[model samples]
Target: MSIKMMPYLILDGNGAEAVAFYVKALGAEVMALQTFGGMPQSPDQPVPDEAKDRVANAQLSIGGAEFMLSDNYPGMAYQLGDQVSVCIITNSKEDSEALFNALADEGTIHMAFQETFWSPGYGIVTDKFGVNFQISTEA
Candidate 1:
């Protein structure tokens, strides 16, 4: 048996934009993008028109690693700086720094990318969409 974990981000109505930004910043590939309107709905539980275009789910791959994301459920409350953070282990220092800087463009940097005790480079940032990230070079 094998076990794997994939982090799922729930953006506050900005999931699609976040996915697009990640594609450019982290060089991630969009595996799938499904909107709420595309999902099958029951007549008794119709989806609201305002949410029809919101992201229901999206799958993205960065290098060989993958993760999923979606817009927050209709009335669910979401707060930034939560306990979860997506960590990326890069192949080289340049890759790690580049990704860290890209994510810091309009985001808050909790830690700047630099030589760390455990790795050649490491940093943490919370992207514009409020998703936290930890970028590091392989140890």
Candidate 2:
């Protein structure tokens, strides 16, 4: 199995606008876009009204380089300039889990590794060094 990584851009509720900007300026091709409202709803933690219009995730490509971004989840702190992260694409679910666990040691697990609508296993973590990573398993 092969692995790859890309840069991830985090936006403070301006993901849609940024996506438009990038498409216009960088000529990026949007691979997919999922808004918070587009996510499957749950009775326990329904999507907040404010988040419905915000971007949950968006994937794009500029030539061969793939990158992604999303609006900060509702009610979460959004610091200025904390906009970049890394996304690791792995072919195996086991590899994704191992990487998530390793990065989560002495670090923050923003989202637990689990199956999502987009991938078999996906998660987010901020390493001890404050570097955030989003691990995704290709379908």
Largest lDDT belongs to which candidate?
2
Candidate 2, residues 1-139, lDDT tens digits: the string is 6799999998989999999999999999999999999999999999989999999989999998899999999789889767999999899999999999999999999899999877999999999999989999998
Residue 27: error of model 1 in Å?
A: 0.8
RMSD of each: 13.2, 1.4
TM-score of 2: 0.91
| Residue 59 alpha-carbon offset, candidate 1, angstroms | 0.5
Model 1 worst lDDT run, 10 consecutive residues: 1-10
Compute the lDDT of residue 41 as modeled in candidate 2.
94
TM-score each candidate. 0.57, 0.91
Alpha-carbon shift of residue 95 in model 2 (angstroms)? 0.7
Q: How accurate locally is residue 74 in candidate 2, as Cα lDDT from 0 to 100?
A: 79
